[model samples]
Target: MSGHIAQDWEPVVIRKKGVAAGQRRDEKAVNEARRSGGPIETIKKFNAGSNKAATSTPGINTKKLDDETEELAHERVPTDLKKNIIQARTEKKLTQAQLAQLINEKPQVIQEYESGKAIPNQQIISKLERALGAKLRNKK
Candidate 1:
């Protein structure tokens, strides 16, 4: 209520020829892929904009940083996470197939996640957290 203009505001400045963050993904559903697992439909949906009519679109299966790329890598749980996943899955009184259906994924994804062989993204963790009514991942 001072002498300040009520409508006083600053406008976002956009520089020409500048690419904004997350612009790298153009409706590829990359976030979905990262969260939902590598489903064939998701792959097709992402690569619809094929410059040269792509033969196949790399989906979640191809994701993850290899040894060559160690800039920002994630470390999978040695045993505790595997146990936690298994325990949580059991506590829900749900089978792998049922859990997959609940999370919109294949049974194999659930198996892999519990086996500690694959990294689960936020969506999966969120589902697990809700189903178990507890946090599943311990982030550092």
Candidate 2:
């Protein structure tokens, strides 16, 4: 079966430029109209959904934000207090289901707690602290 493999020295013809078949459109008029436009005119429709990426991709770096985004953490509250719940659960080595079982609550309730949709009051907090052995409130 290996005898059919092409030789390594074979010349591979690569097309370096020009549009691909079934996907070419005229953009000269669009360029001319843009050249005559005034400044601050919103430039162009960068993302009208139907538009596909073409020759003009104006490169962008898409690395994930890796900074100490703690400054941006507050916004996650209510939508993110669930993080604290997850943390507490992990520290206790308990799954959401296990935690819910201990607390007489539904697994979805634990999810809601973690999602910041349901902030537990003193009673629930105490139950959680007992269940997970964590300090969840101010020490006053």
Lowest lDDT block of 10, candidate 2: 72-81
- Tens digit of per-residue lDDT, candidate 2, span 32-82: 556867232224666677646653554432223443355543232243345
Output the TM-score of candidate 1: 0.42
Residue-level error in angstroms, candidate 1, position 134 = 2.3
Candidate 2 has what TM-score? 0.39
Candidate number achieving the greatest TM-score relative to the actual structure: 1
Alpha-carbon deviation at 16 in model 1, angstroms: 45
